[model samples]
Target: MTPTIALLLIITFLLSTVGLLVLIWSISTNQFSNSQNAARTIFTPGEEGHSEDPAREDTSAYKGDSKAAKEAFTARRVQDQSSKPAVLIWLSSAVFWLLIGSFYGLLASIKMHYPEFMADSQWWTFGRIRPMHLNAVVYGWSSMAGIGAVLFLVPRLFKTPLRGTPYAVTGAIIWNIGVILGLGAINFGLSDGQEWLEFPWQVDFLFVLGGALCAVPLLLTCARRTVEHLYVSSWYFLAALVWFPFLFFIANVPKVFPGATGATVNWWFAHNVLGLWVTPLGIGIAYYIIPKILGRPIISYKLSLIGFWSLALFYSQVGIHHLIGGPIPTWLVTLSIVHSVMMSIPVITVAINHHGTMWGSFGRIKESPTLRFVWIGALMYTATSLQGSLMALRSVNVITHFTHYTIAHAHLGMYAFLSFILFGAIYFIMPRLTDREWPWRRMISLHFWLVAIGILIYFVSLTTAGWLQGLALLDAKTPFLEIVQMTIPYLQARSLGGGLMVAGHIVFVVHFIFMLSRRGAMTQGPTLFRVRTKEISQ
Candidate 1:
């Protein structure tokens, strides 16, 4: 490696080490203690006597003298602690966006086969529709749904009510509006032309505003939590809450950096939006789902901490690896590659923790829809990260770069891993929110099979086809157009996979709508797969 690459690697290593040390110190100092207490504690009036220190008397001496005063304080606290309304609004926003985004994706997929499908319509053109599909999925579906999930999960994990429900609601509204305006602008030819950050400067302000609004509730909820043992999921959620706004704001700043610097920052922000924002939300959900299904605590809290810190440390520098073989400095690419390989530490740590937690519970997966989705998602996470590390290598990138292989890798991470986890989280959370079981266990089972099989077909065909295409391009004897022609069959298969996947999504959406309308059968317990009488008795 060149000196610059060596220096970059050293810098990344030092930063990660320092961050890990700080995390260790914080854990040792009990800083994360009482994280879950905020859920119910805010409902109680003034602080009570500490069980550990009886001499520490209640401080509200004046209020203690009046029974009415104490009751009023308690009532106010309950009002402050409620989060149901905020969660509802956020979820509604997510569902609306998800439908719209999914349709855009369908349109884009079809346009790939029939480029002239909407030839006369400017708004429906491929360029406009492609970005719309991305923005819709990233901002509309994933981010909104993630926020909703976190809003629900954090309170339960922290054992506290969300502190600023109104603020969260406001943020959701602003975020949805921003998404609409941004998509509309891009369709109408008002784009800044950045890949992920395509929205105009004015629209970026709304994102910042929304982000700031959301952060308040998260911080306040963390501050007021009552649970003493901060779960691994909570840690990931809290860190992501802190990381996202910082990266978003820094990346969008105009004219503050040179052209190359801006490109580096933009890609960094683009990549981390997945790593820091979506990845944490997905991982957090997995952390909750795996253990909840098994009715056990995590396998090892120490491994979780190691995974969390290592991810934050190593994943931050991976964007530069994307710029490898480009005009960017060789040092930057080399540094990114090293950090990319180092990512194995976190991936392995998380895999060990998750697998160890579920070591004896594989049988449970058959009966539990949530477990099936989550376990598959967890496994995909390992596969994608390892694939990513290999792809970051210069030798490997030479073949994979600008090919369908990258697309396959992206879907492996985004759809199979992250989207599956989100689906599992929704399955786990919706019953609690609605106070009703799912409409049909059979529908859920069908949904899982369709999506699982569809993704497998999609990945296998495209990956194999992409590898051949890449090899053909590299070979001097192979004709370029013939290589393109060779991919037509795989692309057709991909469309079939997309069709099945879309059908699965439609099934889920229909089920969700029916559940929301209270049209499903009323049941007391969670909807589980029917078992033989003997097994049920056991």
Candidate 2:
């Protein structure tokens, strides 16, 4: 490695190490002593009076409030006035993007096996459509849905009205504009040539502005919060809110760092988009939804503290592992791998807290659509993160990196883990926001099974094909072209899986549209799968 690259890698490693040490120090102290209270904050109601500073919620402002106040709040069950309008606007847009992204994903999958399928149009070229599928799904579908969830959950957690609703609404609108503009630019051959950061430089500013706009309302709502203790979910959401804009702008700024440095930033930014931003929101949603629905507190607040801090300290550094064996210094890649392994600590801790809370709720999983999907996602998060840690090892990376094995792992995290959480969030939040029931229980089940089966097929095929391809490539006698040919069948399987997933998304959108229309009435408590007689009798 060159001296300059080595110097940069050393500096980055030292910075990450210092951050980890600081987090460990804070955890060692009693900074998070009130873990139980943190969990209780959401269930606890606010005083009738609001506070100008959110810090007061933990202090004298509501010191005199009684159990009677909580009873009153529960009886009243204040409507989610802060979140409704903005949520509807943002979530509706998210569903729209999900459809677009899934469709593009299917197209991209088809082009993999059938390069001749749409060869004539530059817009439909696999190169362009592939990134469109990625950006549209990540930035357009997942991020927007996450923002909507945060908008909903933050105010509800704080027992405060959503502040700056107009601004949030405007931000959501502008954010959609950015997604549209960015994707449109890419389709028209204006990509920035970065993986997951393909949107042109000019388009990045719109997202930055849109994100800043969405963030202000969340922060202001926090400032106006009435909860005495910050919930673990709140910490994740707020930290993500702060971290994303910082990464978004830094990674998108042009000419600031050129050539190899820029490539490093590109990979860093791309991976952190998953690790830092969207992953936290998904976990935070789980943190809120699991406990609220099951009426059980998380197993240990200290564990939650550990999980959050470890994730914050470790995840940012782990992103660079994507650059393993690349031009970057070996030290940087080594740091990333070490951090990736350290990540398993947080993953295991979170698994314990989430699953331990649901130990006896197996029946509820079948009964509640939200619980089933979210619970499955929580499990998948454990699976995916652990797999990621394993993949970071040099041995595993040799076979997986740049192969379909990597693709399978990516989907396992994004579609299976993150999308499942968002799916559950939409199902849970929609009825609350629209105050209308989903039209059909069977449809929800159908939607679940289709996507579930589809992804299983997709993941299994790609992983097997990727491992074979990697092994083949490693052999000098094996022809690269023959290895590519061998993957054709798996590519076909992938396309088939993509088709099924697309069909599932279609069912979801149709259902969501019905919910929005006059046809969807608040007719049932929740459109769950049919309960067994034994379960019902109990």
lDDT of 2 by residue, 1-538 (tens): 5887878879879988998888788779867677776776655443312221110101122221457654544322343655788888889999999999999999999999999998998989999999999999999899999999888888887877788898899999899999999999999999988888889989988998899999888889889877777899998998998899899889988778788788789878888888899999999999988876665678798899889988987899887788788887787789899999999999999999999988876777776788778889999999999999999999889878889999999999999999999999988787666646677878898999999999999999999999999888888798889999999999999999888899999999999999888456553332221222212210
Tell me the spans in candidate 2 whose CA falls farther than 4 Å from its real position: 1-30, 44-79, 523-538
Tens-place lDDT per residue, model 1, 321-391, is 77778888786788789989999999999999788888977886787677788889999999999999999
Q: What overall lDDT goes with each candidate model?
A: 0.76, 0.83
Best by lDDT: 2
Clashes (backbone N, CA, C under 3 Å), per candidate, total 15, 1
- Evaluate model 2: give its TM-score: 0.89
Q: Summing lDDT over every window of 10 consecutive residues in candidate 2, give the lowest-scoring window.
A: 51-60
Which runs of model 1 end up more than 4 angstroms from their true locations? 1-81, 257-259, 523-538
Task: Please give the TM-score that candidate 1 achieves against the real structure.
Answer: 0.85
Candidate 1 has its poorest 10 consecutive residues by lDDT at: 50-59
Task: Assess candidate 1 and give its lDDT.
Answer: 0.76
- For each candidate in turn, the TM-score is 0.85, 0.89
